[model samples]
Target: MEDFEILDFLELQQEQQGIDKTARFLQKQIQNGFKISIVIKKQHKFALAPLQQKKNDLFSKQHQPMDVTSQSSEQTENNDKQGSSTSSHSSVKMNKKLIIPPTQNETPEQNNNEQKSEKSDDDQISLYSKKNCSFEHLLKDNLLSQKIQTGLSFMKDGNQKMALEKMMDAYREGNEKLKQCQDQQQISVLIIICIQSLCYASQLLMDFGQFSESQKCLDKCLNQFEINDFDLKCKIYITKAQCNLLNNQYLQCLDNYNKALIQYEQINWRLEVAKLLVKISFVYALLNDFTDAKKICYEGLQILQSKLSHTDPRIYDTYYTLGCIYYLEKDYDFALEYLNQSKEGFIKLYGEQHLSIIRILNLQGVINHLQGNSIDAMELYEQIVCLYGDSQNIGLALVLNNLALVYLDRMKFKSAKLSFDKATAILKVYLNEQHPTFKRVEKNKKLFVAATLSYL
Candidate 1:
């Protein structure tokens, strides 16, 4: 025990000598005014150093460096870590050096330059997103317009099936609620889609002679309509007017036309006014008021002559209306004269195959039949029927009714019944059993039955 204590005392004295030597060295350095400047060489710009680098920084100190054996072991451990950690961290910042503390000449705010650079990058990203979004919206609107145009072209070419498919594709999107829209642009898009869909659907229904369904679509369109859109408003009212005319609702037809006319005149649209005049005169002619009908027809013709050329469509429309009025008055010669004039004008404006001439051909056929020119009338009716094929065209159906009457007069009961059946089938697709056109065909069918019975 005594030998162990003497050895411990010798060890304690050696440790004290070492402590005194380090203190004496530090005091000499301070008295000589030593300035310690840490000049760090950098390889990467990062807020945090790698594990090996941190170890090197912590262990390597002034007047005492890590021994070579310890350094080699640390390097071996860092190599092992590199293989496992490189893949995990290679995606982060590896090209720029770490941000360091500010120097004596630098302001505190200068250290925040990295953060400001990051913020600017974020703003550029946001601006690019907004530009892309605006471009997409433009493409969306143009695509919509193109589809609507394609639908309109199909309608004009009389391809109802293709037209329906095109319209459905154009219409059935963007159904978000207008109230839920966050901006005026969103609300406008919804309103445009609604109006285009409803208007095209209603007009297509009207062309198919489905007046009730057409009216329903038109009613919905009115809810989305803007009051300042007089052109579209006039179109809707005219469609309504035509529906009433076909259904034999003369008073309602007049009311609809008057509504449209009021707006046209308010806008001082003379072209539309002149056209409406011709149509309104026919309504009067249908009521057997020949004097007022002729008066209105001439008034419209004079306005048209002043505004349009001799070959203008409105001029031909005026002539057709006059022919119709004179026909109702049983002035067959005058009716034929005006109808021939209108037919030639229309043939010049639209090609011979165009349906624009159908109404004129029909009037001429009726006049020929009344004048005992059954052959001419038969040719006219057959021509119109051939033009439309077997489509459910209301005009073609009416022509078939007139053709059947010609057959009845000539004692061709079988032919008359065939024509009557075709007309009835077409009208039934469009009109109810009680509609005037349907009833007309039904009433004529009795003649076919009676004649057949008498012959048998």
Candidate 2:
């Protein structure tokens, strides 16, 4: 693909909430025979070179002498033959060789000039490293880069075990590399890689429902990496917030999300700021702080609507959160409106069978049930059962419970009992007996039994 096409692809993936997926997509394109480097080089200003190799190349060039007299004669000869020669090509060649350094046999003055040039190059490299963040080092570390690509490929292919294994190995290798580095700059680069590895590992763990493991990874990152760089620090807070959210620590999650939002705002990362606002609004919704959730969700929606495309998928995140908030507030009409929008967006981006679509569908079903549309609600709930049958996912337990409630509402006692029993079985596999979900299912079963006895 062309540079603009690749950029559009990244934008779309990002809108779909796939930040890390963008690079993996590019690698997949490369594997399919695209010359991605040419496109990347054309768009990015910096040349793609290993930093060490670039330094060595500069050092070697500092010792090669140029003959100014011959250069002058050649240029004069080229001017005479300008009409017959490729003037642009000759001038380019001359420009490229203009900075040749003094040889060992040159005068003492020339040797001093070479030393100054060498020092200047070193200074430039140092400055570049500081200003460019970790890109210089990331681009240079081929093995780390390759491991990341492989790990992500495994992730995309649904080999979660292999993916986690590869990513953990990458993390371990980064640690070893860190121990071998003496230069502060090299150490900084390796640490950046380590942080990146931890981020990926934590995200993977979270995806696999290993919330405790994910939290531990984030803690390790916080302990090892000093929070100095704006982007890295913001990401650390965001990851921690997600872990807290998963663990139902709403207040702690809110604190970290707000911290990340502040950093994003200070950096003028408008998209990230908008995204964090939506996330913080979610925490508010969970805490039943509807006023704050509504306010922040609308503000985030405005930012997204103003800055991004009409079709950008991030708009859906805000809409989904708003729907939940409205549902909590019993604003059923508005809840349905926003939830339908979210459902449509997910379907468009990931097709009907996507897990996210399943969630929106479930919420839509709940809304239908609350609105007294029993037939529609039952249809939606049955659709979920068909789509996610016996997956043992937490969402499946939720769907089953809701479906059981609908069955009970219809006085289908036997079906309700069976559905509640299925939910109880699934929840037991994933949660302890003391879990709230287990207690609720047990109560539901007891109530069903009592009602059946009364009917008998």
The Cα local distance difference test for each model comes to 0.54, 0.56
Q: Against the true structure, what is each candidate's TM-score? A: 0.60, 0.58
Q: List the residue pairs that clash in candidate 2.
A: none
Best by lDDT: 2
Roughly what TM-score does model 1 have, to 2 decimal places? 0.60
Q: Find the candidate with the highest TM-score and give its number.
A: 1
User: Per-residue alpha-carbon lDDT of model 2 for 71-154, expressed as tens digits?
Assistant: 222321111111111112111011132211111112112121122212221121121233353556453554875786688787
Q: What stretches of model 1 exceed 4 Å from their correct place?
A: 1-179, 207-213, 351-353, 389-392, 424-436
